[model samples]
Target: MLFELMRKREGVYNEDRKERTENRPIEEATVPEYLVFPLAMHIGAPAEPTVEKGDKVKVGTLIAEKAGFISANVHSSISGEVIDISDQPTIKGIAPCITIKNDYKDLEEPPLYSEDEELSVDQMIEIIEKAGVVGMGGATFPTSVKLSPPAEKTIDTLIINGAECEPYSTADHRLMVDHAKELIDGVRILVDILSVGTVHIALESNTHDSVEEMKKILDKVDHINIVELETIYPQGSEKNLIKKLTDREVPAGGLPVDVHTVVVSVATTLAIYEAIRSRRPTVKRITTITGEPIQEPKNLLVRVGTPINHLIEECQGFRSKPGKVIHGGPMMGIPIKSGRIPVTKGTSVITFLEKEEAVRSERTPCIQCAECLNVCPVSLQPILISQAYENGDIEEAERLGAMDCIDCGNCSYICPSKIPLLDNIRSAKKEIRARQEEQ
Candidate 1:
């Protein structure tokens, strides 16, 4: 089954690459004039604002301080003047932002540490948390917390996810190609922190070039292994990858750590390398700006607080006003009503879909074909849960296994009748959570 899945993925990837090469656009004429930095981009308690309106801030300067265990700090992306500190439109919708007017001076602070100081495991973890590094792969979970697992949970493996499973997102691919050494170094750092058994770098079979590049770097180290994965949807998922490589199923409602494993994305590892080596927090990320409506598509090293509109402008603006703008990949990404939202750590791609592609026909009655059941990675009956939610039967939905759904959108993507099985199932799950909270 896995072999067939891998063969199909290789075909899809080749087709996608050919199409991208044919449709790729030229460089845009204009660069961005300003970047609106949002103060509350990460999860958990919002960072405390350190700069007020009209304050002059330099690039890499801390603009907000971490407020809690789950939160990360915010930094200035450019050397500029703080024009305003007020609610502004962002990619996540309108939120409070620190609007900075660029001076284009390009001023930056000195490095946080000298090259002579080879940091120990304890020192690296402290620097990572202080620098506010999070999972840049999309989850935005605090890196510090992930490094500190309980004593009872023995971490035996560290998996580096280079799957790049989503279509039209090439940030991870480009990183793996260009910075394989840094990624391997970051994996070493993680392994040292967890005192793990071995490190496995998992790349999709479609990205054979990247896998080879990573293998060359890992050959120098003794503990690292490069594992090729089947090119299936959600192959990059922590649970799925854990199961595929280690044959250890993360029990339902549990985490990969429960199976004595840890998964980190390639981008996240690169960020760790930067945080410890350069003593820099995660103020910027590599983002892929692409789609049919985009004038040009290229992987960009974008600042965290940079607005989506700014990125589009950098790409020479859209060819036409897209029917819809998605913040990440089409399958799991959320639809953005406006492009003015600021990019966060979890923002991997800004995709513009044309009118024809964005249109979804009205949902029809399910035919009980059980197709959703067959494709589900978690083996949940999406139809039953969705139907229960549509009828307002919350308890019935829970009993039918609404909570087991990973919300990967595979069911909706594969449905023949265009029924929004994932949407309805998600709604049911939300209600179940609310009910549990009320109790």
Candidate 2:
């Protein structure tokens, strides 16, 4: 039975998923005059540029090489001349960026790897690494590294996270509905590589179309189960999804591989399929441009280096003045200081909140309500961790498991006192990491 007795999931908040773009088809965004590519888009070491200023590049051109084993490669999304390479404003902060002047040729570089012969597991992985496939669910971890777990860890399960639970984000949902066959093909490739015993496509109940569409495709297929989860915030998290499906808890500071499982998002899976089948690199992705301030809320198939301002313009500008512009969903997205920041691999949604909705109420003292505790998926006490950090107790915060936080921002959302609980915990986690490096 696909619907087995699941462990009663706890500490998850039922959120109103403002999936405004669910019914909208994925529209291709217009290419802008200039595109900016950031080197440090993924986790681990930043990619090193392979091309310099005045060099010509085409779509799928390798502009940057992986700096380390954990980093992914970077490719040009548009045919252009490298105009400048210097520090520029990004969603994170000032970082080394590659600015390209679009030639408007719409030319594409030929496939680097041939797909004429059947691909071996190693060859498949190599292709993905070259394509710069990373987790598209906001964590931008190199997909090549994720697929290749340590030899000791026995991976028994592969879970495709279709639970686009973050409010106002429907990129994954649309991918499933429109491209179910491609997703299943990607899953098969992953299964061959990981040699997992079982495969499960996990989606929230809110994604009815996705579930039904996938089921239709997988009806003849075997060994792949479709599991439905409650529509809860952070239900798409790797740990929580693992717990609900396999009754396995990834220990604090551990990964899904620790529990003998692997989770790949819908967008990343599709990228893998494209990389292997057509030898296409991760040059573009589907990003949801939405919010009440947006004149047109729709899902756009956007190039990697397209600026946020271009996307805003594509949406017919704002219906009203936008008070806050975020890189992803409101719950856990980073606030974009400028629209100049280009869309990275992990960007799934660009949320524009009106002035009224973006207004922050004054933060009051914590009331010991413990609502944060009740909603924390990882069971960490945000109150204690935040307090420890406030008192300059970095070690204390570490001991309280500040590093285990997924930064889901549920604590701050549930806090009745309006405390910036998530911010403090994030600060504490950062300090803990810095001190550890010092040691």
Candidate 3:
């Protein structure tokens, strides 16, 4: 009964430019001589290092343990000696990082569970938690916590997000096309964990190859079906995807679990399968290294803790001097000062922008065109929130629903005056949150 409406909603279509790497087969990146593992890669408390400098670790060895219930464990991607543990630069600022020198010995830890071992719901959750799977679509929320919702919140529908809607990112697309059966089986694992009968794998209409491949593998699977979403920016966002497909509007400042649904990314789903079915931790992921400046754009299956510079080199280095290097897609990616930043579980795309594309236009006063409001997926008034924040009126901003902003950056992109509306709103939200915690 879901998706029958397909009601036209408010969204913007940007230049997807998926052709750069959607058709390119995924290339496995070479192991670097050294790797950097930041403890704060995922959301919530930073994991504490379980291994210290000079300590030996093998692949899949627990290098860092989850510090709290909200955090995730960190595993080694290569067998090596812990060279150092210190605060290192990351996509986010400096954080505690464990650096390792690769021995290339490929020593791996033993499996946590056997395939034939039938596991209960708690065992499956333990497998996911131990494997350190997070929302690989970039949210980086611990997957174990997401799957374990409060009992009062009855989850009836499960949405597997396959919509690679962001521009120039095809890691998820490549995963679906190359490993459709694995993705499907991964969904089945989630279905059993959540005990949900209805499931939908949402993909964008442009990714026909992924859709077709998934369809071929999921043939005759009555419990799980495919839903093609319009090719729109932020279509893969959990809240937006849930609303568009199920017609269930997650309340302001609420999560998908609050609305009787749970959303998992395609990458995270595959990680689930590997953690349970293949006996692996989330040490590697497929990342897109593409942009006009890249000499040879490609989708690379890279290991966690690999340097960004290594990925750039794998793409044949930049053809020209890049004006900007973003850690994710251009739309919502965080711009980094250097390529020394190591790849984390959430690193989906490393986009390089040419000079002309990276230049920032002068910011002018807003002309009151209301363009930002027109494109906000959550229907928040960014301009008003920004104004309230500028005026030191955090109360007004809070009342105007500043916390509801998804930080999708659509307001900044759509602003006629280049007002940086999203930045102001983000700061406001942070301040508001800080003040709330203080109280």
Candidate 1 residue lDDT tens string, 138-239: 887888888878889989999988887776677787788777888888887787788887788888777777777777877564578888887677777787
Using all chains and alpha carbons, the TM-scores for the candidates as numbered come to 0.89, 0.96, 0.96
Per-residue lDDT of model 3, residues 126-195, tens digit only: 9999999999999999999999999899999999998887778999999999989999999999999999
Better of 1 and 2 by lDDT: 2
Residue pair clashes in candidate 2: none
Candidate 1 vs 2: which has more TM-score: 2
Name the Cα RMSD for model 1.
4.0
lDDT of model 1 at position 121: 78
The weakest ten consecutive residues by lDDT in model 1 span 1-10
Model 3: lDDT of residue 239: 87
The candidate 2 region of ten consecutive residues with least summed lDDT is 1-10
> What's the candidate order when arranged by decreasing lDDT?
3, 2, 1
Number of colliding residue pairs in model 1: 4
Each prediction's whole-model lDDT (CA): 0.76, 0.88, 0.89
Q: Which tens-of-lDDT digit does each residue in 270-365 have in candidate 2? A: 999989877899999999999988998989999999999999999999879989988998878888879999999999999888787787778899
